[model samples]
Target: MPVKLAQSSFRDRTQEFQSVAERLRKSFSSGPGQNGPSSNTSRAEEQRSVVAHQSEFNRRASKIGFGIHQTSQKLSNGQENFSF
Candidate 1:
């Protein structure tokens, strides 16, 4: 059997995946190998900022691969609806 979900629910799940990726990136940046916990860590901060930038890039890339990037649409009633 195949798993299925409502469109909105799927959107929520994708958002969760992005959140997890973000958290993992943060954890990776803060780990012992990346930088020390003391002193000015400007380079580490720059790398962290890069990761933050790439995270959205990765998320949109995945969303496009998963065919879920069109989850946002305007309804006839002038409200937003996500359905496919």
Candidate 2:
């Protein structure tokens, strides 16, 4: 791990290592978002999010389409059916 290396790298000078270690510790622990193994967005997760969004969009669009079909049917009620 980089943290171990950072801590061990300063083994020769205890005082300097202590101060750098404190800084490194703060840097590592400062934020929940950036403290993970890989701070960047994972490709698989991004793909999953995109798929989720598209699925939601399709669901909403289908609902709207059904509503439109129902409205058109009601509007055409009792009217002569014309083949177009």
Top TM-score prediction, candidate number: 2
User: Which pairs clash (backbone N, Cα, C closer than 3 Å) in model 1?
Assistant: none
**Range of the 10 consecutive residues with the lowest summed lDDT in candidate 2:** 1-10
For 1-84, candidate 2 gives per-residue lDDT tens digits of 355544444246888989999999898777646656565456458888999999999999999999999988887973655555
What is the alpha-carbon lDDT of model 1 when measured against the actual structure?
0.69
**How many pairs in model 1 have backbone atoms within 3 A of each other, for residues 3 or more apart or on separate chains, i.e. clashes?**
0
Per residue, candidate 1 scores C-alpha lDDT tens digits across 1-84 of: 998965663234888889999988987777455555542376678889999999989998997866643443223434535455
* Global CA lDDT computed for model 2: 0.79
Query: What lDDT does candidate 2 reach at residue 35?
Result: 56
**Predicted structure 2: clash tally:** 0
| TM-score computed on alpha carbons, candidate 1 | 0.32
In candidate 1, which residue ranges exceed 4 Å CA deviation?
1-40, 68-84
